[model samples]
Every structure is written in C-alpha cells, then in structure tokens.
Target: MPISSLARSITGAGRRFPPPLARDPHAGCAKPDRNLPPDRTASVIHKPHILVVFGTRPEAIKMAPVVAALRARDGLDVSVAVTAQHRQLLDQVLAIFGIVPDVDLDLMQAGQSLDTLAARILTQFGATLDARRPDRILVHGDTLTSMVATLAAYFRQIPVGHVEAGLRSGNIYSPWPEEANRKVTGVIADLHFAPTPQAAAALRAENVPGAAIHVTGNTVIDALLAMRDRIAAQPALAAGLDPLAARFAGRRIVAVTSHRRENFGDGMAQVAAAIARIADRPDVGVIFPVHPNPAVRPVMEAALGSHPNVALIDPLDYPHFVRLMAMSVVMLTDSGGVQEEAPSLGKPVLVMRDTTERPEGVAAGTSQLVGTDPDTIVNRMFALLDDDAAYAAMAQAHNPYGDGQAAQRIARIVDDAHRR
Candidate 1:
C-alpha cells in the first residue's frame, strides 16, 4: 500500500477498537489464566497472553521492540493496545512496524486537559480489562496513559511489567507529572524493567523487591537498531534525503526536537532562540524537524523557520530520525528518547529540559542538561562546537542504558512472569 493509504487504513481501522472502559463489569474478575497443559503438551505449547499498552510516539517507539520480541517467542501471545494519545505520530510508528494494534483507544482531542485524559483512560481501561483480561500488562515509561492503565491494572491486582522503570529526576515537579507517575507506577508494578544500573539502583533504593527488577537496557536502542535495518532495506527512502544528508555529510548536523507541554510558551521560545544562535554559526547547521503541534509550530517557525543554515522540516519517521542521529555532531532537545538514543550512537546530547528521568546518560557524560535558558543552551552548543576533544569525550562515553538486547530480555522476563 502507498504510505498515504497505509496511514488512512490504520487510522480507519484504529477507530473500530473500543476505548477504555466506561463501566466496569469485570474489573474485579480480571485475573491471570493459571493453567498448564499436560507436561509434554506444555513443553510444546502454552502461549502466555501479554497485553502491551502505550499511547504517545515515544512510548510506541520504545515498545515496538518489545512487541517484536514477544511475538518472536515460542509461547507468548502478544497484543498491543495503543490509547492514541498522540494520534498521527502514534499511527506512524504502528504503520512502520506493520503491526496493527488489537485495540486503539483513539483518545486524543483538541484542547483536552490531563484530567480528561486520565478519566477517559480509567473509564475505557476498566471496560477493556473486563473484556480481554490478559495475564500481564506491560506499560512503557511514564505517560498519563501508562499512569492510568497501570492504576486500573493495579486496582484489579493485575501484574504490570514496567519497561524503562526506575528512571527518576527525584524532584516531582521537574518533569511535571511524569516523575510522580513513574514513582507511583513503580509501587504498583510487579516487574520493573530498569534500563541501566542506575535505574535498577533507584528501584532497589525504593525497596522494590530485587526479584522483580531486571536490568533490560532501554528498548529504544533496540528499536533504533531495528529501524536502521529497515531503512537500509528501503534504500529508495534514502534517495530523497541524500542531498540534505550530504549537506550534513562530513560535518555534523545537530538533530533538534522539542515539544513537551511544560515547554510550550516561554520554554519553547528559549529553545527556538538556542536554535537561532546555533544557526548563526557558519560551519554548524541545525536540522530541526518541527512538530505538528500548533503551539510548537508558530514559535519554531517564527524563530528558526527562514534561517539560511537551519533545516526545519516536518517530523521524521523513526528510521529517518535514526539516520539523522547517526549523522549528528551533537543533539540538542528536551526529548527523553534522544537522551537514550544519542548515547548509543556515540553522539553527545544537550538536553533542553530542566530535569530528565534518564540521568544515567548525564552520569555517563553522554548528555548535558542545559535547561531552557537560551544563554545556557547557546553557550553549551558553542562549547561543544569549539572544543573537538570535549565533544569526542562526551560522544565516546559508554551508554549506561544497555547493550541493545532489551527487547529480548524483556520478552524472556515476561514469559518467566507468566509461568509463575
């Protein structure tokens, strides 16, 4: 199918899935299916049902690897349920993987508040669980969708395996609701998929049972690696991007992306200003893919739009984004996924956020947290540009996350969880 048609097909198919439960008929009855076939039969067959829930683009990116891993297993039935918190972006990831979600909540709305999102997730989730009632729920990272889904599962005592768990900024308000969401989910989660030793340590410090925690590296790196393979298979896509990729050919391209709700007005303005300053440099060019969010578009267009060197285009697909990351000299953005991805590519990242849950990257010297202050962002960008040795040191630092087998490891853990 054509890319445009695929997008339409997925969106049209997605609407048919039911939303989170509005009424709970089976919330109390949702329980694990604890049945073992005869010893000989069980050895050959006894597929465990694992329900994976994610909504945003980041979540989708991070979870795709896990979904692939689970599907590849000998005895596991994997079903993906996307809440469609990010709409188009979410669908793009799903379409790329060619894995249609078994259930899509289609929860996005214009001018929707977080409260409405939470309530809708709760209502709809209650109903979904009552209907499907999988053996285990696998939720990735922290988002309102994950938060609500984890809570709903917890209420029924459903086992939740939290991928990329134990990430912490400590300060609850720094990452805004996310810090709280992850911590709370940590309390309710049965298995914690910690991406780094630091993350595992945090979970340990929290007194979460060591038996429940597994150091499975960040699944995003696995997805990035997989995406690179996919991109190589379709070299035609690389044709249109070659010239632009060549413009960033030998030289570094600073792959930039910023669009967090906390950084909408003033924070976005500061991010734009930082890009403008970077664009002024004769040698270094900024490649910022503008997000579709209206709040982000105007500010980005107003600041970095018409710049001679800065290439502001539409948001890239997962594969394009990875190729760009591999070509980048340094990454500048507030995105959490970038923090994890850049380190694996040996690229140094300058985070625009004031706080990050992925402090493992910073501790590993792979990333620098330069808050939304334009001056701080500019100065750091220049420092990295001017000092090659400093740039190399940061870029070459070992990624603390994982060795990129996170998806496989998570699949094994989920299988083990089901047997018990």
Candidate 2:
C-alpha cells in the first residue's frame, strides 16, 4: 500500500479495507432461549485497543512488521505511536514501510540530552495514554525511548508487551545504556516476545514466568525478507547505488556501519584506521554509510575522506541499504540488526564489538566477533578478502534469527490475549 492509503486505512479516513465483521461472543455455545428472556439472547463483543510505541530508526524498522500484522487482523484495534528520537532517520523507515503513526510525539530537538528526551517522552506519552486510553501498549527492544515509553505505560497500570525482549550482555555498561534499558523493560513487560531460545532462557533465568515468554523469531528478518522481495520485483527502488557500484566495479566491496557509543573517540578512530588499511589494497574498495552523529561522522571523514577507493557517504535508505548488503562481499558493522540481517543474505558479518547480546550468530558460525582493535579488524578483513574457505564457512552457516513469520506470531498472540 502507498503511504497515504495506509495512513487513511489506519485512521478510517478513506477506508481501503472493508469494515470488520461482527463477531459473536458465544459462537460455540448453545443458542439462548429468546422467547423466555431477552437478557440471555443478546451477546456483547468488545474490541480491545492496543497502542504500539517506538522511537528511533531501529525501533521503527523492527516495529513496522508488527504494525502491519496487527492492523490486518480482526477483533483488535491497533494504533502506532513514534517518539521520533532520531527524527529524520525514523521518518525514512516509516515511509518505506507505509506506516502512519496515529500519534507522533515529535520529541526530537537539537542537542537534546538523554534525561530531557526521557522526560518529554514520559510527560507527552502520559498525556497520550490518558487521551487514547488503550488497554495495552506494545514496545520494542531497548532504546531510551522504549524504556521510557514502557515506564509511561507502567505508571498507568496498563499491561505492556515487549518485542525482542530478554537480551543481556552481562555487563550493562559495555553496550552502554542499551543493555540496561532492555533489562528494565524485561521487568515491566508482561508479554515477552523473545527472538531465540537463548533469549527465552535468559528471561527464564531472571525468573520471568515461562508462560509469558514466546519464542518468536526476530522481526528484522521479516522486514528484511519483505524488502528483499520488494526490491527483487521493483529493481528501481534501490537504483541509487548504481553510481557507487560503477565506481568500484572491478573490486570487491565491503559495506560498513558503526555508531556504537562504546566505540566513540579511540574506538571509532581505530575503526577508520582499520578501514584505511583495508582500502589500501588494490583489489578492495570500501563503502561506508557514515552516521551523521557529530561524535562519528567527522572522525571517519578525517581519516578516510581522501581515499580513492573509499566511498564515505550518507546513510542509504532501506532498499538502497539492502542493495548494498546484497552486492557487498562481507558485512562489517556494530549494529545489532546487521548481525541478524547479513546472514540472511549469505553475508558474513564481522561484528565490531567485544561482546554481543545476540550470541546465536557467533555460536552458529554466521558471524565472528572482532572488536575495535585496528590490527584484529584488518586481519579479519584480509582473511575474508583473501581466502574463500574462511568466507564460505561463515556465509554458509544458518541464520538462527528468524524465518520471516515473527510478526504474524506476535499478532496472533496479541489477538488471543486481547480475546481473554
């Protein structure tokens, strides 16, 4: 569906879909005696309202599939709310997925600190909860936005369902605030949609009741598969990468993404140094979608801006990014989504972190952990670039993240819970 049409369908403006069919509350029960009394004859049916909330690009991307699934089902009224923490980046995913958020907090501001953003999301979303009065609120993963949004819902005693829950890195500060944010959400979230057996096990270890945890696959794979198919049919959707592909036609391309807070000053510089070493090769070229954060963009540009074989460009949109992944020889990123996504495309991911919450990929042989050490990164890059056997071993391994039906499972679970 087009963005406008989807928005209209969500808001009941144009009504592209047919009205929901009336459901009988007592479908399987025996018919009541209408002649004796009318009170027993009539049945009351109530549709539970669910509010889905997210903020930032990753949250938006992961939640897009869930929104589509929930909206397509009957007996549930689903509404989307975006905190817009990463304003421009969040909107890009929203457009690609054709999701029209029923309530947009528009909370992003110049140089907004963490505490300020949290305060705004809590205050504004508290008001939203009061006005919308949804029966439950669904939150995704661990962003400051997710944690704060979950808190807002908790304040009102509204039940919250957490998607991609039960990720733990042991040390909360290593992945910075994310590890802590997810753990906090795990405490308040009544319905835990864990992506892997490992994640479910982690939740159980924490004493989160086993009944609340559902082992649905990660939704990123669902989004990735859907977009991959879309691009396959409509090649023009990702045509923006033609020039970059042409520039490095004869050489193998390495797609890179890094913007972790742990890898800020020294870590980011070393990463640029590693890329510089790899780009020095005559047979290799690097395509890095430099993040726009002041802490990151300039550091990378200073180290690699003038390199002939390096294309340090702005972030590509969804389809274009998918195209980058499809054509690239190896995936290099610190992104949690990339770890799950690259393996689906048969791309070996060299995770740029010492520890990862998604350890299934490492144990499954789809990826390897090569932290921010310049020497280690260079060695790993060269190993994959020079040897086919090493590359194939990682590429051929199974992607344990998902099979592309997570959103459907999540929608069904939510619908069933609401029916109760």
Candidate 3:
C-alpha cells in the first residue's frame, strides 16, 4: 500500500480496504467436536485458553512475538484481541507479523476523550471476556486498554499476565498516566514479565511477590531481531527505504519519530526546531516519519516542512522503520519501544522526554534522555553525529533488552501459570 493510502485506511478516508482479517469465533482455539463423546469434548474445551490483548501499535509490535510463541506450543490455545487505540498504525504491525486478531473492538473515534475511550474498552472487552471465557489473558505495556482490561479481568476473577511490567519514572504524571497505568497493572497481574532487572526490582519494591515476577527481556527485541533477520534475508522486505537511501546517499541520516501526548504543542515545536537546525548542516539529513496525530503533524509541518534536507513522510511499515533505524546514525524519539529497539541495532537513541520508564538504556550506554528543549536535543544529537568517539560509546550493539527469546520464555511462563 502507498504511504498516503496507508494513513487513510484506518478512517476509510477516500480508500477502499478489503476488510481486515475476519473475526473467528473459536479464535486460535479449536471448537470442541460435537460428534465426539461428551466426556472427550469437555476435555478438549478445557485445554487452557490464553487470550492476548492490546490496543496501540507498540503493544501490537511487542505482543506479536508472544502470540507466535504461544501458538507454537502444544496443548495451549491462544487468541488475540486488538482494541485498536491507534487504528492504522496498529494494522501496519499486524500485517507485518501476520497476526489476525480474533476480536477487533474497532473502538477508535476521531476525537474521543480518554475517559470516553476507557469506558468503551471496559464495556466492550468485558463482553469479549464473557464470550471467550479465557483461562488467562495477557496485556502489554501501559496503555489505557491494558489497565481497564485488567480491571475487567479482575472483576471476572480471571488471572491477568502483564508483559513489560515494573517500569517506573518515579513521577506518575510525568509520563502522563502511563506510569500510573503500569503500576496499577503490576498490582493486578498474577504474572509480571518485566523487561529488565531494574523493572523487576521496582515491582518487588511495590510489595509484589517475587515469585510472580520474571525478568523476561523486552519482547520488542524479539520482534526487532525477527524483522531484522527477514530484512537481511530478502532485503526487498525493507526496500521501502531504497528511495530515501538514494535521496540521502552520502549524508548521515537521522531517523526521527515523536507522538507522546505529554509533548503536544510546545514540546513538538521544540523538536521541529531542533530538526530544522540539524538539517541546516549540509552533511546531516533528517528523515522524520511524521505521526498522524492532529497535534503532532501540524506543528512539525509548519516548522520544518519546507526544509530541503528533511523528508517528512507518513509512518513506514515495520520493516521500513527497522531499515531506517539500521541506516541512521542516531535515533531521535519519545517512544518507549524505540528506546528498547534502536539499541539492539547499534543506533543510539536520543529520547525527547524528561523521564523514561525504560531507564535501562541510559544506564547501559545505549540511549540518552535529552528532553524536548530544542537546544538540548540539538546539542546531544550533535555529539553523536559529530564526534565519532561519543557516537561509538553509545553505539555499542550490546542491548540490555533481550536476546530475541523473550517470547519463548513468556510462553513457557504462561504455560506454567495455567498448569498450576
């Protein structure tokens, strides 16, 4: 799909899309055979049902590996449900991973308030639970979907598993509800699949039982490694970047992305200014995939749209984004997933937020926090772009995240959780 049409497919804006994967009533699990004896059918129906739920693009990316891992196991039935908090972007990842959501809430509105979105997920997902009756459900990260889904599962007395749990920025409102979201999930989740040791420790500090906490490295690395290998084998999978590679042949490319709600107006403006200033250098080119959010796209376009060296394009599919990260000298973003992903590719990430729940990167010399202040963003990014020594220090391909087996570990843990 062309980039323009990809953006509009979520809204049906001037584009006709074949419907997404059809909803399957039995989901990834099999329907019990009615022809068989009643005793045998009951046994088949009791084969532990695991439901994987997520809403946004990041959640989809991280959970895809877990879903794949679970499906590969014997005697375990896995189903996927996407609430689609971020409609088209989430679809892009699902297509890349070949994930067919058993239930798509289809709950995105043009301009819905957080309270409204939460209410819809709570009620709709509650209905899905009533029908699916999963043995245990898995939710990823700190989205509102995960939080309310956990609440719904708790009300129904179903066990919940949290992937990428135990991250804390110390200040709840700094990440603007995400910090709170993850903490609340940690409280309710019987299985906490933390991405790092620090994250596991945070959960312990919160009085969570250590037995429940397992440091399964971030699944983003699993997803990243898998795509990176695919791009390596075929190379055509990531051919979307061929044009950009030709456009900025000799110049150093700086891949950029930002869509954090905290950095809406002024914060976005600062990031744009920094990009424009970086683009001023003839040797450096900025390739920013402008986010489709109303608050983000306008600010960035108004500030840096006319810049000659900058390519402000629509968001790329998973392989293209990974290809961009592999091609870039440095990554600039406020995305939590990027913080974990870029490092595995040996790309130093300059975060645009004041605080990050994933602080493992900073301590591991893989990423740096350079808030949204244009000066800070520019100066910090320049250090990596200009100084080879500085760049090499942060460019260590040693990822503290994971070794691409997180999903397997998570699958094993989930299997154990139900076996008991």
* Best model number under TM-score: 3
lDDT by residue (tens digit), candidate 1, 1-420: 111121122221001112223433223222334364456454433355678999988899899889999989867767888889889788777877787888888999977888999999998986787777666788988898888998888766567889999999988886878888888888888789999888998999998888888898899989887777766887654344565777765655788988877898989998888788888877877777777788997888877767877787766766667777877888998888898888888899999887788887888899999999989999998998899999989989998877779999999988876675
RMSD of 3: 6.8
TM-score of each: 0.88, 0.90, 0.92
Candidate 1 regions with alpha-carbon error over 4 angstroms: 1-46, 246-251
TM-score of 3: 0.92
RMSD of each: 6.5, 8.5, 6.8
Give each model's whole-structure lDDT: 0.79, 0.85, 0.86
The alpha-carbon lDDT assigned to residue 156 of candidate 2 equals 78
Give stretches of model 3 more than 4 Å off: 1-28, 33-43
lDDT of 2 by residue, 149-219 (tens): 88887777777899999888898886988998999888988899999999999999998888899999999
Clashes of each: 7, 0, 0
**Deviation in Å, model 2, residue 88 alpha carbon:** 0.6
Scored against the true structure, residue 395 in model 1 reaches a CA lDDT of 84
The Cα error of candidate 2 at residue 91, in Å, is 0.7
Which segments of model 2 are wrong by more than 4 Å?
A: 1-45
Instruction: Give lDDT tens digits, candidate 3, residues 169-223.
Output: 9998879889888888878888899899999998888888888889999999999
Q: Could you say which candidate leads in lDDT?
A: 3
**Cα misplacement distance, residue 187 of candidate 2 (Å):** 0.2
